[model samples]
Target: MTFPAFVDLLRQLYVNVAEHEFALPDKQQTDSRVSLLTGVHRKEVSRLRGAGAPVRVVPDSVSRTSAIVARWLADPQFVDARGTPLPLARTSEAGEPSFAGLVESVTRDLRPRAVLDDWLDRKLVEIDDEDRIVLMEGAMVPRGDGEVRLYYFARNLGDHAAASVENVLADAPPFLERAVHYDGLSEELARSLEAYSREIAVETLLRLNKYANQAIQNDPGGSSRWNWGVYILTSDATSLVAEETPENKNAGGETA
Candidate 1:
Protein backbone atom coordinates (compact mmCIF):
# COMPACT_ATOMS: atom_id res chain seq x y z
CA MET A 1 0.00 0.00 0.00
CA THR A 2 3.00 2.32 0.30
CA PHE A 3 4.29 4.34 -2.62
CA PRO A 4 7.57 2.42 -2.82
CA ALA A 5 5.80 -0.91 -2.90
CA PHE A 6 3.39 0.39 -5.52
CA VAL A 7 6.31 1.48 -7.67
CA ASP A 8 7.86 -1.96 -7.42
CA LEU A 9 4.60 -3.51 -8.50
CA LEU A 10 4.49 -1.16 -11.48
CA ARG A 11 8.01 -2.17 -12.45
CA GLN A 12 7.02 -5.81 -12.27
CA LEU A 13 3.99 -5.09 -14.45
CA TYR A 14 6.25 -3.38 -17.00
CA VAL A 15 8.46 -6.43 -17.10
CA ASN A 16 5.41 -8.58 -17.62
CA VAL A 17 4.25 -6.53 -20.62
CA ALA A 18 7.74 -6.45 -22.08
CA GLU A 19 8.22 -10.18 -21.72
CA HIS A 20 4.84 -11.42 -22.92
CA GLU A 21 2.46 -8.94 -24.52
CA PHE A 22 4.39 -8.36 -27.72
CA ALA A 23 6.48 -11.50 -27.83
CA LEU A 24 4.04 -13.31 -30.08
CA PRO A 25 2.08 -10.95 -32.29
CA ASP A 26 4.21 -7.86 -32.34
CA LYS A 27 7.67 -9.23 -31.63
CA GLN A 28 8.74 -5.61 -31.32
CA GLN A 29 8.83 -5.34 -27.56
CA THR A 30 11.63 -2.85 -27.23
CA ASP A 31 12.66 -1.45 -23.86
CA SER A 32 11.44 1.98 -24.94
CA ARG A 33 8.00 0.62 -25.83
CA VAL A 34 7.70 -1.07 -22.47
CA SER A 35 8.91 2.08 -20.75
CA LEU A 36 6.37 4.20 -22.59
CA LEU A 37 3.49 1.82 -22.02
CA THR A 38 4.32 1.16 -18.38
CA GLY A 39 5.78 4.60 -17.47
CA VAL A 40 8.79 2.80 -16.06
CA HIS A 41 12.24 4.14 -16.83
CA ARG A 42 13.92 2.77 -19.96
CA LYS A 43 16.92 1.48 -18.03
CA GLU A 44 14.70 -0.31 -15.50
CA VAL A 45 12.64 -1.85 -18.29
CA SER A 46 15.81 -3.23 -19.84
CA ARG A 47 17.08 -4.45 -16.51
CA LEU A 48 13.83 -6.17 -15.64
CA ARG A 49 13.52 -7.71 -19.09
CA GLY A 50 17.09 -8.93 -19.13
CA ALA A 51 17.12 -10.26 -15.57
CA GLY A 52 14.74 -13.11 -16.46
CA ALA A 53 12.43 -12.13 -13.64
CA PRO A 54 9.43 -14.31 -12.97
CA VAL A 55 6.49 -12.33 -14.29
CA ARG A 56 2.99 -13.04 -13.12
CA VAL A 57 1.06 -15.29 -15.46
CA VAL A 58 -2.20 -13.61 -16.29
CA PRO A 59 -5.09 -15.67 -17.60
CA ASP A 60 -6.18 -14.58 -21.08
CA SER A 61 -9.71 -15.91 -21.52
CA VAL A 62 -12.59 -16.76 -19.19
CA SER A 63 -14.07 -20.23 -19.09
CA ARG A 64 -16.92 -20.56 -21.57
CA THR A 65 -18.63 -23.23 -19.47
CA SER A 66 -18.70 -20.86 -16.52
CA ALA A 67 -20.21 -18.13 -18.66
CA ILE A 68 -22.95 -20.51 -19.82
CA VAL A 69 -23.83 -21.46 -16.28
CA ALA A 70 -23.95 -17.83 -15.24
CA ARG A 71 -26.37 -17.15 -18.07
CA TRP A 72 -28.61 -20.01 -16.98
CA LEU A 73 -28.79 -18.59 -13.49
CA ALA A 74 -29.48 -15.04 -14.69
CA ASP A 75 -31.78 -15.64 -17.61
CA PRO A 76 -35.46 -15.71 -16.68
CA GLN A 77 -36.49 -17.93 -19.54
CA PHE A 78 -34.23 -20.54 -17.98
CA VAL A 79 -35.74 -20.28 -14.46
CA ASP A 80 -38.94 -21.66 -12.94
CA ALA A 81 -41.71 -20.25 -10.71
CA ARG A 82 -39.58 -20.45 -7.57
CA GLY A 83 -37.00 -18.13 -9.19
CA THR A 84 -34.46 -20.96 -9.17
CA PRO A 85 -33.01 -22.17 -12.45
CA LEU A 86 -35.15 -24.91 -13.94
CA PRO A 87 -33.77 -28.29 -14.82
CA LEU A 88 -33.95 -27.95 -18.54
CA ALA A 89 -34.42 -30.77 -20.98
CA ARG A 90 -31.41 -31.59 -23.12
CA THR A 91 -33.40 -30.97 -26.27
CA SER A 92 -36.33 -28.68 -26.85
CA GLU A 93 -39.89 -30.04 -26.95
CA ALA A 94 -42.60 -28.51 -29.11
CA GLY A 95 -40.98 -25.08 -29.18
CA GLU A 96 -40.29 -25.18 -25.47
CA PRO A 97 -36.82 -24.07 -24.37
CA SER A 98 -34.13 -26.58 -23.44
CA PHE A 99 -30.60 -26.54 -22.04
CA ALA A 100 -29.21 -26.55 -25.54
CA GLY A 101 -31.38 -23.60 -26.40
CA LEU A 102 -30.09 -21.74 -23.37
CA VAL A 103 -26.47 -22.27 -24.35
CA GLU A 104 -27.16 -21.39 -27.95
CA SER A 105 -28.81 -18.16 -26.87
CA VAL A 106 -25.55 -16.97 -25.38
CA THR A 107 -23.02 -18.43 -27.81
CA ARG A 108 -24.21 -19.50 -31.21
CA ASP A 109 -20.77 -20.52 -32.42
CA LEU A 110 -20.15 -23.03 -29.64
CA ARG A 111 -21.94 -26.34 -30.17
CA PRO A 112 -24.62 -26.66 -27.49
CA ARG A 113 -23.98 -30.34 -26.82
CA ALA A 114 -20.28 -29.71 -26.44
CA VAL A 115 -21.00 -27.00 -23.89
CA LEU A 116 -23.35 -29.36 -22.07
CA ASP A 117 -20.73 -32.08 -21.94
CA ASP A 118 -18.14 -29.67 -20.58
CA TRP A 119 -20.55 -28.45 -17.90
CA LEU A 120 -21.46 -32.00 -16.89
CA ASP A 121 -17.82 -33.10 -16.77
CA ARG A 122 -16.95 -30.09 -14.64
CA LYS A 123 -19.87 -30.83 -12.27
CA LEU A 124 -21.26 -27.34 -12.80
CA VAL A 125 -24.53 -28.97 -13.76
CA GLU A 126 -26.26 -32.29 -13.12
CA ILE A 127 -28.63 -34.45 -15.12
CA ASP A 128 -31.78 -35.58 -13.33
CA ASP A 129 -34.07 -38.60 -13.58
CA GLU A 130 -36.00 -37.19 -16.54
CA ASP A 131 -32.74 -36.32 -18.32
CA ARG A 132 -33.23 -32.69 -17.37
CA ILE A 133 -30.05 -30.67 -16.95
CA VAL A 134 -29.93 -28.86 -13.60
CA LEU A 135 -27.53 -26.05 -12.93
CA MET A 136 -25.53 -26.09 -9.71
CA GLU A 137 -23.91 -23.49 -7.49
CA GLY A 138 -20.48 -21.90 -8.04
CA ALA A 139 -21.00 -21.68 -11.77
CA MET A 140 -18.69 -18.71 -11.93
CA VAL A 141 -16.07 -20.17 -9.63
CA PRO A 142 -13.56 -22.56 -11.10
CA ARG A 143 -13.50 -25.94 -9.30
CA GLY A 144 -10.16 -27.79 -9.25
CA ASP A 145 -9.10 -25.72 -12.26
CA GLY A 146 -6.57 -23.40 -10.75
CA GLU A 147 -5.37 -22.05 -14.09
CA VAL A 148 -8.83 -21.06 -15.27
CA ARG A 149 -9.62 -19.44 -11.95
CA LEU A 150 -6.39 -17.49 -12.07
CA TYR A 151 -7.18 -16.19 -15.51
CA TYR A 152 -10.63 -14.90 -14.59
CA PHE A 153 -9.50 -13.63 -11.21
CA ALA A 154 -7.02 -11.32 -12.90
CA ARG A 155 -8.97 -10.44 -16.04
CA ASN A 156 -12.31 -9.68 -14.41
CA LEU A 157 -10.79 -7.69 -11.59
CA GLY A 158 -8.70 -5.66 -13.99
CA ASP A 159 -11.62 -4.81 -16.26
CA HIS A 160 -13.92 -4.07 -13.40
CA ALA A 161 -11.46 -1.60 -12.00
CA ALA A 162 -10.89 -0.03 -15.38
CA ALA A 163 -14.62 0.46 -15.86
CA SER A 164 -14.96 2.12 -12.50
CA VAL A 165 -12.12 4.51 -13.27
CA GLU A 166 -13.57 5.31 -16.67
CA ASN A 167 -16.92 6.07 -15.16
CA VAL A 168 -15.35 8.45 -12.67
CA LEU A 169 -13.55 10.28 -15.46
CA ALA A 170 -16.37 10.32 -17.95
CA ASP A 171 -18.24 13.57 -18.59
CA ALA A 172 -21.67 12.20 -19.41
CA PRO A 173 -23.62 9.03 -18.80
CA PRO A 174 -21.14 7.30 -16.52
CA PHE A 175 -20.44 3.68 -17.52
CA LEU A 176 -23.01 1.89 -15.37
CA GLU A 177 -21.70 2.57 -11.86
CA ARG A 178 -24.66 2.45 -9.47
CA ALA A 179 -25.52 1.06 -6.02
CA VAL A 180 -27.81 1.27 -2.98
CA HIS A 181 -26.85 1.79 0.67
CA TYR A 182 -28.55 0.92 3.95
CA ASP A 183 -27.15 1.71 7.39
CA GLY A 184 -29.09 -0.46 9.84
CA LEU A 185 -29.98 -4.09 9.20
CA SER A 186 -30.02 -7.26 11.27
CA GLU A 187 -27.69 -10.17 10.47
CA GLU A 188 -30.55 -12.18 8.99
CA LEU A 189 -31.49 -9.35 6.62
CA ALA A 190 -27.86 -8.86 5.68
CA ARG A 191 -27.54 -12.54 4.83
CA SER A 192 -30.73 -12.40 2.82
CA LEU A 193 -29.43 -9.39 0.89
CA GLU A 194 -26.19 -11.22 0.11
CA ALA A 195 -27.98 -14.16 -1.49
CA TYR A 196 -30.41 -11.83 -3.19
CA SER A 197 -27.54 -9.84 -4.65
CA ARG A 198 -25.98 -12.95 -6.14
CA GLU A 199 -29.18 -13.97 -7.89
CA ILE A 200 -29.67 -10.52 -9.39
CA ALA A 201 -26.04 -10.02 -10.32
CA VAL A 202 -25.86 -13.39 -12.04
CA GLU A 203 -28.88 -12.56 -14.17
CA THR A 204 -27.53 -9.14 -15.15
CA LEU A 205 -24.13 -10.51 -16.09
CA LEU A 206 -25.77 -13.26 -18.11
CA ARG A 207 -27.74 -10.70 -20.09
CA LEU A 208 -24.59 -8.76 -20.78
CA ASN A 209 -22.76 -11.97 -21.72
CA LYS A 210 -25.42 -12.85 -24.23
CA TYR A 211 -25.21 -9.52 -26.03
CA ALA A 212 -21.44 -9.27 -25.83
CA ASN A 213 -21.02 -12.75 -27.27
CA GLN A 214 -23.34 -11.83 -30.08
CA ALA A 215 -21.32 -8.70 -30.83
CA ILE A 216 -18.11 -10.70 -30.85
CA GLN A 217 -19.62 -13.19 -33.22
CA ASN A 218 -20.77 -10.44 -35.53
CA ASP A 219 -17.36 -8.84 -35.53
CA PRO A 220 -14.95 -11.69 -35.08
CA GLY A 221 -11.85 -9.58 -35.56
CA GLY A 222 -12.69 -6.60 -33.37
CA SER A 223 -9.67 -5.25 -31.57
CA SER A 224 -11.28 -3.91 -28.43
CA ARG A 225 -12.52 -5.97 -25.49
CA TRP A 226 -15.82 -5.28 -23.68
CA ASN A 227 -16.79 -6.32 -20.18
CA TRP A 228 -19.21 -5.59 -17.33
CA GLY A 229 -19.11 -6.52 -13.65
CA VAL A 230 -21.40 -7.10 -10.66
CA TYR A 231 -20.42 -7.38 -7.00
CA ILE A 232 -21.94 -6.99 -3.50
CA LEU A 233 -20.73 -5.97 -0.07
CA THR A 234 -22.26 -6.05 3.45
CA SER A 235 -21.52 -4.88 6.96
CA ASP A 236 -19.25 -7.12 9.01
CA ALA A 237 -20.63 -6.45 12.53
CA THR A 238 -23.94 -4.59 12.44
CA SER A 239 -22.13 -1.42 11.50
CA LEU A 240 -23.04 1.29 9.04
CA VAL A 241 -22.44 0.23 5.43
CA ALA A 242 -23.67 0.94 1.94
CA GLU A 243 -25.42 -1.51 -0.36
CA GLU A 244 -26.25 -0.98 -3.98
CA THR A 245 -28.66 -3.02 -5.98
CA PRO A 246 -27.79 -2.49 -9.63
CA GLU A 247 -31.22 -3.62 -10.65
CA ASN A 248 -34.51 -4.59 -9.06
CA LYS A 249 -34.60 -8.31 -8.35
CA ASN A 250 -37.72 -9.43 -10.14
CA ALA A 251 -39.39 -12.79 -9.67
CA GLY A 252 -38.38 -14.01 -13.11
CA GLY A 253 -35.09 -12.14 -13.44
CA GLU A 254 -33.50 -8.69 -13.09
CA THR A 255 -34.48 -5.33 -14.57
CA ALA A 256 -31.47 -3.05 -14.69
Candidate 2:
Protein backbone atom coordinates (compact mmCIF):
# COMPACT_ATOMS: atom_id res chain seq x y z
CA MET A 1 0.00 0.00 0.00
CA THR A 2 3.02 2.31 -0.12
CA PHE A 3 3.63 4.42 -3.20
CA PRO A 4 6.30 2.05 -4.47
CA ALA A 5 4.01 -0.96 -4.04
CA PHE A 6 1.19 0.80 -5.83
CA VAL A 7 3.52 1.74 -8.64
CA ASP A 8 4.66 -1.84 -8.94
CA LEU A 9 1.07 -3.06 -9.09
CA LEU A 10 0.14 -0.51 -11.73
CA ARG A 11 3.24 -1.43 -13.67
CA GLN A 12 2.22 -5.07 -13.56
CA LEU A 13 -1.27 -4.24 -14.79
CA TYR A 14 0.15 -2.22 -17.65
CA VAL A 15 2.38 -5.08 -18.68
CA ASN A 16 -0.54 -7.50 -18.51
CA VAL A 17 -2.68 -5.28 -20.68
CA ALA A 18 0.07 -4.83 -23.22
CA GLU A 19 0.89 -8.50 -23.35
CA HIS A 20 -2.63 -9.91 -23.32
CA GLU A 21 -4.60 -7.15 -25.03
CA PHE A 22 -1.95 -5.70 -27.31
CA ALA A 23 0.34 -8.61 -27.94
CA LEU A 24 2.64 -8.86 -30.95
CA PRO A 25 3.14 -12.16 -32.78
CA ASP A 26 6.81 -11.73 -32.07
CA LYS A 27 6.88 -12.75 -28.40
CA GLN A 28 10.30 -11.27 -27.60
CA GLN A 29 9.10 -7.77 -28.50
CA THR A 30 6.33 -7.69 -25.83
CA ASP A 31 8.54 -6.07 -23.21
CA SER A 32 9.47 -3.23 -25.58
CA ARG A 33 5.81 -2.68 -26.45
CA VAL A 34 4.85 -2.59 -22.81
CA SER A 35 7.67 -0.13 -22.10
CA LEU A 36 6.49 2.21 -24.88
CA LEU A 37 2.84 2.06 -23.77
CA THR A 38 3.46 2.39 -20.01
CA GLY A 39 6.67 4.49 -20.04
CA VAL A 40 8.21 1.85 -17.78
CA HIS A 41 11.89 1.03 -18.28
CA ARG A 42 12.35 -1.70 -20.85
CA LYS A 43 14.54 -3.65 -18.43
CA GLU A 44 11.86 -3.50 -15.75
CA VAL A 45 9.19 -4.41 -18.27
CA SER A 46 11.27 -7.34 -19.41
CA ARG A 47 11.61 -8.56 -15.88
CA LEU A 48 7.85 -8.29 -15.30
CA ARG A 49 6.67 -9.48 -18.72
CA GLY A 50 4.52 -12.63 -18.91
CA ALA A 51 4.01 -12.64 -15.17
CA GLY A 52 0.38 -13.64 -14.74
CA ALA A 53 -1.93 -10.88 -13.62
CA PRO A 54 -2.20 -10.73 -9.85
CA VAL A 55 -5.29 -12.39 -8.40
CA ARG A 56 -6.80 -11.78 -4.98
CA VAL A 57 -6.84 -14.76 -2.67
CA VAL A 58 -10.30 -15.83 -1.54
CA PRO A 59 -11.03 -18.16 1.37
CA ASP A 60 -12.17 -21.56 0.13
CA SER A 61 -15.51 -21.64 1.96
CA VAL A 62 -16.75 -18.08 1.34
CA SER A 63 -18.57 -18.85 -1.92
CA ARG A 64 -20.51 -21.81 -0.56
CA THR A 65 -21.36 -20.04 2.70
CA SER A 66 -22.43 -16.94 0.80
CA ALA A 67 -24.65 -19.01 -1.49
CA ILE A 68 -26.34 -20.75 1.42
CA VAL A 69 -26.87 -17.49 3.26
CA ALA A 70 -28.28 -15.83 0.15
CA ARG A 71 -30.66 -18.70 -0.42
CA TRP A 72 -31.76 -18.59 3.19
CA LEU A 73 -32.59 -14.94 2.72
CA ALA A 74 -34.34 -15.49 -0.62
CA ASP A 75 -35.80 -18.97 -1.01
CA PRO A 76 -39.45 -19.02 0.03
CA GLN A 77 -38.88 -22.40 1.56
CA PHE A 78 -36.46 -20.81 4.01
CA VAL A 79 -38.12 -17.44 4.55
CA ASP A 80 -41.53 -16.31 5.76
CA ALA A 81 -44.12 -14.40 3.68
CA ARG A 82 -42.47 -11.09 4.60
CA GLY A 83 -39.18 -12.38 3.13
CA THR A 84 -37.44 -12.64 6.48
CA PRO A 85 -35.41 -15.77 7.17
CA LEU A 86 -37.11 -18.17 9.55
CA PRO A 87 -35.58 -20.12 12.37
CA LEU A 88 -34.87 -23.57 10.97
CA ALA A 89 -35.26 -26.84 12.79
CA ARG A 90 -32.08 -28.90 12.94
CA THR A 91 -33.05 -31.61 10.46
CA SER A 92 -35.26 -32.06 7.41
CA GLU A 93 -37.35 -34.77 9.10
CA ALA A 94 -38.40 -32.20 11.68
CA GLY A 95 -39.94 -29.86 9.05
CA GLU A 96 -39.43 -27.90 5.83
CA PRO A 97 -36.64 -25.30 5.67
CA SER A 98 -34.70 -27.14 8.27
CA PHE A 99 -30.96 -26.44 8.49
CA ALA A 100 -30.21 -29.88 7.07
CA GLY A 101 -32.44 -29.31 4.05
CA LEU A 102 -30.89 -25.88 3.35
CA VAL A 103 -27.34 -27.18 3.43
CA GLU A 104 -28.11 -30.14 1.20
CA SER A 105 -29.87 -27.84 -1.24
CA VAL A 106 -26.62 -25.93 -1.67
CA THR A 107 -24.18 -28.83 -1.35
CA ARG A 108 -24.14 -32.32 0.08
CA ASP A 109 -20.37 -32.64 0.44
CA LEU A 110 -20.29 -30.62 3.66
CA ARG A 111 -22.35 -32.09 6.44
CA PRO A 112 -25.13 -29.86 7.73
CA ARG A 113 -24.12 -30.50 11.32
CA ALA A 114 -20.51 -29.45 10.58
CA VAL A 115 -21.58 -26.26 8.81
CA LEU A 116 -23.95 -25.46 11.66
CA ASP A 117 -21.16 -25.91 14.15
CA ASP A 118 -18.85 -23.65 12.15
CA TRP A 119 -21.52 -20.97 11.83
CA LEU A 120 -22.15 -21.10 15.55
CA ASP A 121 -18.44 -20.65 16.22
CA ARG A 122 -18.30 -17.74 13.74
CA LYS A 123 -21.37 -16.16 15.39
CA LEU A 124 -23.18 -16.22 12.07
CA VAL A 125 -26.02 -18.28 13.51
CA GLU A 126 -27.42 -19.18 16.90
CA ILE A 127 -29.90 -21.61 18.34
CA ASP A 128 -32.89 -19.91 19.86
CA ASP A 129 -35.17 -21.05 22.72
CA GLU A 130 -36.91 -23.49 20.42
CA ASP A 131 -33.47 -24.80 19.40
CA ARG A 132 -33.93 -23.62 15.85
CA ILE A 133 -31.00 -22.24 13.84
CA VAL A 134 -31.35 -18.50 13.31
CA LEU A 135 -29.20 -16.34 11.09
CA MET A 136 -27.80 -13.11 12.55
CA GLU A 137 -28.38 -9.90 10.65
CA GLY A 138 -25.68 -9.11 8.06
CA ALA A 139 -24.34 -12.63 8.45
CA MET A 140 -24.21 -13.14 4.68
CA VAL A 141 -21.32 -10.74 4.32
CA PRO A 142 -17.96 -11.67 5.76
CA ARG A 143 -16.92 -8.75 7.94
CA GLY A 144 -15.03 -10.25 10.85
CA ASP A 145 -12.38 -12.06 8.83
CA GLY A 146 -9.78 -9.44 7.95
CA GLU A 147 -8.61 -11.24 4.83
CA VAL A 148 -12.12 -11.69 3.44
CA ARG A 149 -12.92 -8.07 4.25
CA LEU A 150 -9.78 -6.90 2.44
CA TYR A 151 -10.65 -9.01 -0.60
CA TYR A 152 -14.11 -7.48 -0.79
CA PHE A 153 -12.72 -4.00 -0.14
CA ALA A 154 -10.43 -4.34 -3.14
CA ARG A 155 -13.14 -5.78 -5.40
CA ASN A 156 -15.81 -3.18 -4.64
CA LEU A 157 -13.53 -0.14 -4.67
CA GLY A 158 -11.52 -1.37 -7.62
CA ASP A 159 -14.58 -1.97 -9.81
CA HIS A 160 -16.06 1.45 -8.98
CA ALA A 161 -12.79 3.17 -9.77
CA ALA A 162 -12.48 1.24 -13.03
CA ALA A 163 -15.94 2.31 -14.08
CA SER A 164 -15.13 5.96 -13.41
CA VAL A 165 -11.85 5.71 -15.30
CA GLU A 166 -13.59 4.19 -18.30
CA ASN A 167 -16.00 7.09 -18.34
CA VAL A 168 -13.28 9.75 -18.11
CA LEU A 169 -11.30 8.07 -20.86
CA ALA A 170 -14.48 7.75 -22.98
CA ASP A 171 -13.94 4.05 -23.41
CA ALA A 172 -16.99 2.72 -25.24
CA PRO A 173 -20.03 2.14 -22.95
CA PRO A 174 -20.29 4.24 -19.81
CA PHE A 175 -21.06 2.84 -16.38
CA LEU A 176 -23.86 4.00 -14.06
CA GLU A 177 -22.41 6.15 -11.24
CA ARG A 178 -24.65 8.78 -9.72
CA ALA A 179 -25.05 10.63 -6.42
CA VAL A 180 -26.78 13.65 -4.84
CA HIS A 181 -24.57 15.95 -2.80
CA TYR A 182 -25.86 18.87 -0.77
CA ASP A 183 -24.40 21.42 1.64
CA GLY A 184 -25.52 23.99 4.24
CA LEU A 185 -27.17 21.30 6.34
CA SER A 186 -27.77 21.54 10.08
CA GLU A 187 -26.45 18.55 12.06
CA GLU A 188 -29.99 17.38 12.79
CA LEU A 189 -31.05 17.48 9.15
CA ALA A 190 -27.87 15.71 8.04
CA ARG A 191 -28.42 12.97 10.60
CA SER A 192 -32.05 12.56 9.53
CA LEU A 193 -31.13 12.29 5.87
CA GLU A 194 -28.34 9.85 6.75
CA ALA A 195 -30.76 7.61 8.62
CA TYR A 196 -33.26 7.67 5.76
CA SER A 197 -30.50 6.93 3.27
CA ARG A 198 -29.31 3.89 5.21
CA GLU A 199 -32.81 2.46 5.54
CA ILE A 200 -33.48 2.72 1.81
CA ALA A 201 -30.01 1.43 0.93
CA VAL A 202 -30.33 -1.71 3.03
CA GLU A 203 -33.77 -2.44 1.62
CA THR A 204 -32.59 -2.03 -1.96
CA LEU A 205 -29.60 -4.32 -1.43
CA LEU A 206 -31.60 -7.02 0.33
CA ARG A 207 -34.27 -7.03 -2.37
CA LEU A 208 -31.69 -7.37 -5.11
CA ASN A 209 -29.79 -10.07 -3.25
CA LYS A 210 -32.99 -12.06 -2.90
CA TYR A 211 -33.91 -11.67 -6.55
CA ALA A 212 -30.42 -12.68 -7.67
CA ASN A 213 -30.37 -15.67 -5.38
CA GLN A 214 -33.56 -17.09 -6.83
CA ALA A 215 -32.60 -16.21 -10.40
CA ILE A 216 -29.26 -18.00 -10.31
CA GLN A 217 -30.53 -21.33 -9.02
CA ASN A 218 -31.14 -22.65 -12.53
CA ASP A 219 -28.00 -21.10 -13.96
CA PRO A 220 -25.13 -23.12 -15.21
CA GLY A 221 -22.06 -21.29 -14.02
CA GLY A 222 -20.91 -18.58 -16.40
CA SER A 223 -17.73 -16.56 -16.66
CA SER A 224 -19.28 -13.13 -16.25
CA ARG A 225 -19.38 -11.81 -12.68
CA TRP A 226 -21.86 -9.20 -11.52
CA ASN A 227 -22.24 -7.07 -8.41
CA TRP A 228 -24.37 -4.21 -7.13
CA GLY A 229 -23.13 -2.11 -4.21
CA VAL A 230 -24.20 1.06 -2.38
CA TYR A 231 -22.83 3.46 0.20
CA ILE A 232 -24.12 6.42 2.26
CA LEU A 233 -21.98 9.28 3.55
CA THR A 234 -22.71 12.23 5.80
CA SER A 235 -19.70 14.31 6.67
CA ASP A 236 -19.36 17.10 9.28
CA ALA A 237 -16.52 18.86 7.45
CA THR A 238 -17.11 22.58 6.81
CA SER A 239 -16.02 22.31 3.16
CA LEU A 240 -16.55 19.80 0.40
CA VAL A 241 -13.84 17.19 0.01
CA ALA A 242 -13.22 18.33 -3.54
CA GLU A 243 -13.63 21.74 -5.23
CA GLU A 244 -17.25 22.86 -5.05
CA THR A 245 -19.52 22.64 -8.06
CA PRO A 246 -23.25 22.98 -8.66
CA GLU A 247 -23.71 19.31 -9.36
CA ASN A 248 -22.13 16.24 -7.77
CA LYS A 249 -19.52 15.16 -10.38
CA ASN A 250 -16.85 13.42 -8.36
CA ALA A 251 -16.72 9.67 -9.08
CA GLY A 252 -17.23 8.31 -5.57
CA GLY A 253 -20.61 6.48 -5.51
CA GLU A 254 -23.31 7.01 -2.87
CA THR A 255 -27.03 6.38 -2.43
CA ALA A 256 -28.24 9.74 -1.07
Shift in Å, residue 82, candidate 1:
10
- Report model 2's TM-score to 2 decimal places: 0.74
What digit string (tens of lDDT, one per residue) describes model 1 on residues 31-139?
8877776678889888878765433443322445656665676566776664577889988999877988987876787888887787778787888998888887756
Error of 1 at 129 (Å): 0.7
Runs in model 1 lying further than 4 Å from the true structure: 1-63, 66-118, 167-174, 183-185, 210-221, 237-256
**lDDT to native, each model:** 0.66, 0.75
**Top-TM-score candidate index:** 2
Worst 10 residues of 2 by lDDT: 247-256
The alpha-carbon RMSD values of the candidates against the true structure, listed in the order shown, are 9.0, 4.9
